[model samples]
Target: MKFVIHDRNNAIKVIDSDKDQDSVVKGRFVQDVLYELASKNSMEFIGWCHKDLEDFINHDQLNSIFHHELIMASYSTTGDYEIPEAIGYIENSTTFLNVKPDVNYPTWLMSSDIGGMHAMVILKFENLKGSTKTSFDGFLNHISKTALSEGLFCYSSPGLLKKDSVSIESRQNKINLFYFVRHHYRSRWLPLLFLDYLLYEK
Candidate 1:
């Protein structure tokens, strides 16, 4: 992959053939400037409206960051209910939440990815009989309700819902959903119907 770096005046330019396609040249540079500026100014760098990191990121990068935040923020709500673990890791970093979360954890939501609004939640059904159903109907109902009521949506993968999870444990179960939200950027992966519901409700 070829990469180009240009100075503010367009007088200085550097090229790199080794830079990856997803690499962020402008973002890294902007981040450095924001950090120095914030340090000197004594304020938050990434979240600042005047110099928000959102302004510096491209769509693809923003999407990756959004996904990262969704996982992180959704992490906080995991195992919140009676379940032992609401979300479980699949690959080392990739996780599986039972249902969707109320919030999306964005990389830029807070100072660092780890410190940001990483939330996870488990929903437990009480005094329930029969196996906890996680079929299409149940999943749709839960996701729709959340989206309609809270302006949240189930993140989407290419062919299926973005939720990562497993079957319920006994009559006691946790509905796991993983999500993250950032203040500025919106992901197309979000539940569009929910967004419509929110707009209409308001």
Candidate 2:
């Protein structure tokens, strides 16, 4: 598994050897780079666009920044939700009992809503292999369980469908799906925090 980080400009910021395959290692590397950028008051990195950190200081400021532009740009340019030629692809299982497996799983974290700083993780899988419905069920169970443990809502969409469907309604449906998922899962206080940050400051 290769780990590479790129900015909104599509410029490579960091690339590590296979030795850094651990998610924790990759996360730390990304955090280090983010802090480095924040220290310089630089929003050149994609992570800085999501939130307003005008009065935030040091580490707190770094964590608050989640740029929406970065997510849109990356997904629009390098992301291959429908096609497997670019970043990767997640297959759609036809039967309820089968779960497709992929050779590579690529994950990204970004904000899904416009002008909101909440973060969502997107995972894409490619070169799907055999399937077991039990495994698929387990996967969903695990996602739901993990989301509950973390106090966050987790949802999965059919990557193939998103690729094939291009209607405006389809796009809106996707957004709505996420909206409802978050609406049900998130605590009421989360929105209040965002509102406080947006309305009172600057």
Candidate 3:
């Protein structure tokens, strides 16, 4: 099978086979396409690789460049308003699992309740500049047609109001937390104080 994801003027085609042996190839193709999209847009693509997820969660040096708070927020908000039908679609169809982040670009995966083996994509307009709910809906409609042509299922939830804006002020506030600890904690009890602040304040 083959699927194409259309993003504005750009379209990405991903090829896969129905055979089980070709599953690995299909997975790699999907990853490559997703990575290309992310790179082209100056974003980051984090897939379902266990090591990658562990490294991202544990603050491993390999993926240390990503903001910890931003990642946590993404995880927390991804399934905030999931559609009930999405679980059925995911279980009965082939749905991709991945995290695509570009500073403020709001794209998240809504996993199924059945062991989270499948997920649907949820996109928000607030993360998109100069975009409205209508434009976003149109984009999804276009992609759904392409997905249908390739014998695949593509689902997205309705666009909702922007809740978390990752504006400059928010970024600065997160940065200032580290700076405050660095400048104020200078004594032997500094580690304790910092730990307390992280546990209580954060």
Candidate 4:
């Protein structure tokens, strides 16, 4: 059974999840995408990673976040792919994702529009209805506290919130990525820190 939740942050973990012969080929492509994205996100956000900085989400880091549902449950549990068109939500800190599963060669060929004001991972969910409660909760938790909050009245949506048309931008070589890190972190230092520079940069 596959976890309904997915993201580029741990694309390798996802890649590692499957060990089929096909995954071998796809995994290589995913690594290339990861290399490109982790480098850009780090470089823009904190002036780290000069095309060869080794701090993209490590194996341990992936293990730490593997149980996203569990950690997020304490977080009031919540929450795509090619996603030719889906109501995507982003704030800042874009992540790379041209495709999901990245397990098939077909997906690799499909172009991606991963740019956004938020950290995004390219993913694809087949037969998503099976995990509605789990997936939706994950989705809500992902985008929660993001809409509006006068500090007193935080708003939420009962149904799925989606957009008819979505657009993607290029974050390559962009800067000030640290500026928006505060808005997304769960009021924590490590999260923002990790996103900006990962485990290294003291």
Candidate 5:
């Protein structure tokens, strides 16, 4: 399932999904989109690939708790094919935006918009609902305190909320997902770090 994230700092930067806004875009449309997003949001950009995840873990200098495996990667780009419109939400003041990822080929996927001063990490897993509540709570506890305060919301065949077990119907039938937000800048990576814990235990 995808989490549709919205950030006040980053609105949906419209891509000319149509012609006319044509630029020599190729290879990494996702990166291009991300860079554009970062530029718009005025944040530094770091585009990590599948290989980067593994490589970062092996490197000594970049010994970070954050890794690539914890992130949901998207393959489709505007460079290879037509890039479609991306819709993200902005919390009333534009501080928070829940941007759910669009579908990709073969296996469905999700994405995290890690821009602005805040970092984001989106994790995709199967059978989470069927899993135990302790499993989820463990994930919530593992992340930084700031993330815990912001809490999380689950989205799926029927959207669910962690704060309140409310199920909202979603047009997208196949994906089920939730979003955990970390409001404190210092603990931003806590949610992403907990991803490995969730995958291993559940």
Candidate 6:
């Protein structure tokens, strides 16, 4: 297996080789991330993106260091919501940056391969006492569009219908969503919906 690191410029370059299809992730995911998270004996660096998409892509990679100000800028209803962060071994280079956080627990979010402004959510039903990820992109989309129209950003959106989360989202949750927005533009997200629900559907 030939692992090749293709730059964003050659996102779709073709190499006529008999080495089976090269392991390449084009434009949808952060290549560096895949390289670190994926399984391979030796895959080439083949990805798609202009550059490191953190400063302005999803939630911002580092604020001078970890551009997570958007998540931090949001105010939470919960008085003591501790902000969480993404700890990509390949991204942060080290775990020492977390400092001494009050709640140092871990968090993870996964999304299906959806695209463009669409979002996935887990609807928890008190009656059923269960939760499920919905193809609810339309709902989240409407909320985001409405929120923007109301002079708000998704980061500050509450992420629910007739309820709310403890805080905007643990800083970690918000930041992770931001990262999601950055790379997977149309993938399902774990973040809550926008603040105001203008249109409700039965």
| Top candidate by TM-score | 2
lDDT of each: 0.25, 0.25, 0.27, 0.23, 0.24, 0.24
Using alpha carbons, what is the TM-score of model 4?
Answer: 0.18
The TM-score of candidate 2 is 0.19
Tens-digit lDDT string for candidate 5 (1-202): 1111222122232322122342322332232333344344432212222221221211221112113222222221111111111101111232122333232122112222111111232111121223333222222212322232343221111111112222222122111112222332235455543464365534
Q: What is the Cα-based lDDT of residue 111 in candidate 2?
A: 21
Error of 6 at 18 (Å): 28
Q: Number of clashes in model 3?
A: 0
Candidate 6, 15: how far from true, in Å? 20
Cα displacement (angstroms), candidate 6, residue 169, comes to 16
lDDT of 6: 0.24
Cα shift from native, residue 198, model 5 (Å):
20
Give per-residue CA lDDT, model 6, range 1-202, as digits (tens): 1122223222222221234453444543232222332233222211111222111122121122112211111112332222222323122334234433233222112111111111111111111111122122222222333334343333321221113222222222443334434443433332322221112211
Each prediction's TM-score versus the true structure: 0.18, 0.19, 0.18, 0.18, 0.19, 0.16
C-alpha-based local distance difference test score of model 4: 0.23
Residue 192 displacement (Å), model 6: 13
lDDT of 3 by residue, 1-202 (tens): 1222222223233322222221222322322333443344333322222211221222222133232212311222243222222222213343334434223232222211100001122122123323332222232323233334444332221111123322111111223333333433345444555565566655
* lDDT minimum window of 10 residues, candidate 1: 108-117
Error of 5 at 123 (Å): 17
lDDT of 4 by residue, 58-169 (tens): 2232233222221111110011222111111223312224423212111111112211111122111222223323222222223322322312111111111122223223
RMSD of each: 20.1, 19.4, 19.7, 19.5, 18.9, 18.3
lDDT of 2 by residue, 17-84 (tens): 22333222232233333333334433332222111211121222222233232221111112222211
Model 2 segments more than 4 A misplaced: 1-32, 41-43, 46-72, 76-180, 183-202
Task: Give a tens-digit lDDT track for model 1, residues 1-202.
Answer: 1112223111122222233332333433322332333344342112111111212223232234334422211122122322212222111223333444434422111111011111221111111112233321222223223332343323322111123322222222322222321111255424552454356535
Each candidate's number of clashing pairs is 23, 5, 0, 14, 18, 25
